[model samples]
Target chain A: MIKVQQKDFNYSLEVAALSEGNHDVGGVCAFSGLVRDLVGDKHIDYMTLEHYPGMTEKCLAEIEAEAHHRWPLEKTLIIHRYGRLEPGDQIVLVAVSSVHREAAFDACRFLIDFLKTNAPFWKLECTGGDSKWVTAKDTDTQACDRWLNGDKKE
Target chain B: MKILYFSWVRDRIDLGNEEIVLPENVTTVEQLVNWLQSKGDGYASAFADLSMIRVAVNQEHVKLGHPIGENDEVAFFPPVTGG
Candidate 1:
């Protein structure tokens, strides 16, 4: 499942839902991304996330499907929030369930990595008096590429 | 055809989306981008650097050489920076 929303999500509820009704699953990995308070040396008061209305959902679904194809995950969930958010607010969540821990761990990491590059979302960081659009870091793109080359580094 | 812009591209272009009728010869994304650059100052500056921009046809990422059609929706934006 994949969700893109303006409202905040419940982490415990979502993790439990992923782990529920599955006795055979030995591990469920969940990763949550938070808005950082600083961009380099500047303190970010808040951030406004913007996304292409119809395209964002389609891109996220494609990422989720690719994760399932690459790993042995029994279930997967991705939830991302948009609109204005505080420094400590939750930005995204990726949870994966599998019979073993390796698949769950690897797939959960892969989902977040791909989401950073593949999803059509943009972030604007606001300071006290000014704001700027965040650009994609070279490192982030390289992280996503590593997976495509079959180089998994945990 | 519909064209959409996002992020800094939208801010620079000062417009989000618009509908246009093609000339029936614009076959690839590169040709359409070149045509848009000639429309006005906003588009010219917004698309000043082709390397810094990314294009998508029908909501999927595509290169400049990707083929486009009259009914397709094409979007232009900067590289993604969200998770």
Candidate 2:
């Protein structure tokens, strides 16, 4: 499942419901991303996110399909929020369930890494009465590229 | 053709989207950037550095040599910062 919304989400409830009633799924791996309080010493008051309407959803769906193709995942969930979000708010969540722990863990990390570099969302940082657009980091591109070269087991 | 700008490009260009006619001989994204620079000061400033910008043809991320056609949705923006 994939969802992009502006409302707050309950991580515990969402993960529980995703893994419920799946006997074959012996392991579940999940990751939740939260807004950090500091960025290069800037105190962030809030972040305003914008994304393309139809394109953003389509891009995420493709990423999810890629993960399932590479791993034997029983279930997967991705939730990303937009609009004005303050520090300590949840930004994104990824959960993967599989019969084995390795596939579950790998798929969960793959989803988040790809989302960082490939997603269409844009963030504006509001700090100390000033607002500016954040630039893409080279580290994010490197992280996504690591998956293209080989799997974690390699 | 529809042209969409995102992130810092949208902020600098002062608009998110617009419609324009593709100039002749502007087959690739690089050529299109040069054509756009001549439209106005804002367009020139937004596309100042060709290397720093990224392009997409019909919502798919593309390279500078990607082909663009009539009725296609073209987007230009800075590198993504989402995670």
Docking class of 2: medium
Q: Estimate every model's Cα lDDT from 0 to 1.
A: 0.93, 0.88
Off by over 4 Å in 2: A151-154
lDDT of 2 by residue, A1-154 (tens): 9899999899999998767998998899999999988998778899998887777888899999999999999999999998999999999999999999999999999999999888888899998889998888888888889999884632
lDDT of 1 by residue, A101-154 (tens): 999999999999999998999999999889899989999999999998887943
- Residue by residue across B1-83, what tens digits does model 2's lDDT show? 89999888887789989998887788888788888888888888899888789888899999988888778899998887776
Clash count list over all predictions: 0, 0
What DockQ results for candidate 2? 0.80
Range of the 10 consecutive residues with the lowest summed lDDT in candidate 1 chain A: A145-154
